[model samples]
Target: MDEELYLIKDAGVSPRQVRLARVIVGLLVLSAVIATPLATTPLLPIPGYMSAFGIAMIVVNIILASLLFAKGLIESKESSIRLGAAYFFVTVIFVPLIAAFPGGLMEAPIIGSNSSAVWLWCSWHTGFGLLIIRYATSSDDTAGTATSVRKSILATIAVVALLTLGATLGLPYLPEVFRNGRNFFDDSTILVPALVFGVNAIGLLCVMRMREEKPERLWVMVGMVAACIDVWLTLYGGARFSLGWYFAKITSLFTSLVVLISQLYGITRLYHGIAGANKILMTQANQDGLTALSNRRCFDQVLEIEWNRARRDKRSLALLMIDVDHFKKYNDCYGHLAGDDCLRQIAQQLLRVINRPGDVAARYGGEEFVVILPNTDAAGARLVAERLLLNLSAASIPHADNQPLGQVTLSIGVSATVPGPGASTSALALAADKALYEAKESGRNKVCTAPRELVTPAPPAFLMS
Candidate 1:
């Protein structure tokens, strides 16, 4: 029988564990109300009328538990496991209290110790209900309009008010009207519990409202729900209604333990998921698709930002523009696919040559690339460009049309300037392009530096005469 029951339980797994848990909890409450009184009455030595009344109270408890659990299951935003755990904890605490203090139970006519307990219980659970409602409706994004915050605050206040009224008007005085010539309100049975419930309810709502908008709010929601249920059961039971009294105590103990456990689990899951997502986004933004080096977009953004800083500090900046000679011809001869492979090989060579924190190489466009060298002058830039030419000449990528079977050469141009108010990025780029044109014009594969001096040619010899 046990094995069969376990199988039946195991088969019902789904994404919403809270939903399933609610169903199970509802059934347990139902069974407790129906079975407990019937079995206990015959065994107890109470009067026949009292026994019948006890049975009737059990029936009422069944109805109330069913209604509350149904509503909670359908409407509750809390996870099933959380709800289940809360119900379990509440039951544990209330069972012991009732068993230990049967005569101490609130009498029908007046407020007393039981009344206080009931008040606390109902207050706690009502607060829990408000939390559940808030959590279900709240979005993950908190930077929304102020209207959302105002609405939440108003809803929370309303919940607190309802809890307060329920404890004050329903628990203590209602029973007094049934008893002739006895003042139930004067007994102070319901007063202390009502006050306790009211205070706790207000505090719980305040704390919930104060929480920063985050998924973590879900755990707080669970705690509030457990606490609210506890208050409700206590208040109703204090009416000297047997079923209400039993359920009030039982559910309070059950709900507390479960809520705590659920909260811990939820927090852990939320943290890990958020951390993982952030890491993935960072990686994607920085990494190149083809070469696995920093791509052009990243290089452009980083260079502009660093350039402004360097300009402010009066530092030198150099740029190198490198192009693969006869790259288009090579692509035409061996197909575009081979050209891509050649480009990848050159990209790797650039990576090996430019090894500095502030130096970066990027594929500026088809068959052309750019390198930014911060704090480097024309001399430093020339040396780096020459080195890159030498490195590419040595690292021979396969080229069939050329004399060598696997030799690739690059024409590199170096341009440097100490940035001032008039020194724009476009001017620097143009200077580099002119230098690159000089290298290509001089020969197919060589390094060229832009002339530092602007020389005006002397008049032609015949014109001078």
Candidate 2:
């Protein structure tokens, strides 16, 4: 999961900003859904001539157009954002004049390019074509792109301003298209909207092909479909006051909704995925794969922790370094696969026997395991080693090649100490390791201890059992 979008940290949008944006988007969608049907429905007891659907459409369309512009400006990197901006331009600048007068001709300074419904349709498809280009090409450096976005915004405002000025000045332009009590397919209406929907569909397909992340792609795809539906209704769905026009408004609501829902869902999945990956990484770090015991890293950490505790309490700490007897020979005879299984069995037995709160059992290295017994004396350490041997023998794992009485056995070296100011964990570990070597030298499958004297070379082979 990416932090980029999930928490909005990468995008740099604050939570308060997102919430406010959402509220505005929500209001725009809800208004779109209700405005047309409420003003145009025939089920109401209002006179057909008094239908206010056209007025409602203009208001809702302008509001939706502004939202799209705001969204595109904020998300300047996305081509889909440009599509939103294009929608705003078409609705606020073009839709009103065309809806109000589809047949009114202009003959003055600047021509009304969108004076006809057919011309408006052409401009709509052109906007979507630009969107497709944006989606295919990744944007510039974010800082650079934001600058570009600001310039684009100023330009759009100017363009919008110019068109309004022209309309107000009665510049030369073609009349508009479609009206109540007017035939939908009459004079280029049917063909124009069909072409617009076709262009939108092609742009949508291009978007899906270029992107692989589904969450990011879903909203745009849905918006394109809604756009197609809106075009379809404009072409074949009776007149302005018909049910089709109302449904077209509903599709308008759908366009905004898809963006909100997909973004939120994408964020949720990211959080869960990151959490799951963290858990797996933690397990792999601390646990031994072959034996399922704490790995050497975990042993090192626990030993350091317990060593400090012993030094603080002025209590004795014991370490048992246990090695499987003739483990090389065991692997050679049984194969490495069986050797791994043998280690798992041995580790499981050790875990069951060493169940004290202060005891920590870990796989220290190949064929060598260790247990830290905090607050334990040599006597208690010996008892644990003995019990471990008994339990392992009781399990009766086979090892018929060598040893004094071996059916797979452990040689354990016990080291116990009361730590002082000069004490260190490495010194304790070295003492335990030497004790293990002595136990192996004396005879395999024996328990031995480091003697009180730090005389190094086994101190005459220490003690044995």
User: Which candidate achieves the best TM-score against the true structure?
Assistant: 2
TM-score of each: 0.52, 0.56
Give lDDT: candidate 1, residue 353: 78
Deviation (Å) of 123 in candidate 2: 8.5
lDDT of 1 by residue, 1-465 (tens): 334333323322244654645564566456455544432121222334333433333343333333323433443423232223223323322322232222433323133233433343434444444344443444334333334333433554455455445544555543332123311133444664565456546635654674353323433444444454445444433344445444544444444434444434444554555566656566567656666666677777877876786688888788888898888778878898888888888888888878898788877777888889999888998988888777777776766665443467788888877677556666667778889999989875777877643111234588778
RMSD to native, candidate 2: 11.7
Where is model 1 poorest over a 10-residue stretch in terms of lDDT?
Answer: 177-186
For model 1, the superposed segments whose C-alpha errors exceed 4 Å read 1-166, 170-283, 403-406, 453-465
Q: By how many angstroms RMSD does model 1 differ from the true structure?
A: 14.8
Instruction: Please tell me which predicted candidate would have the highest lDDT against the true structure.
Output: 2
lDDT over C-alpha atoms for residue 117 of model 2: 38
List, in order, the clash count of every candidate structure: 40, 7
Candidate 2 per-residue lDDT over residues 1-465, each given as its tens digit: 244234433433346544654565466456445544443343322232222433443455455445544554555544534544544554454443444233322222133433333344445445544554465454423322455455555665666565455454443443344344454545645565556677777766776675444434545655665666665554455454466555665664455456555555545655666676676678779999889888999999998999898889988899999999989999999999999999999999999888788798999999999999999987888899999989988998999776556589999998888776557788788888898999999986889988744312332334532
Minimum summed lDDT over a 10-residue window in model 2 is located at 100-109
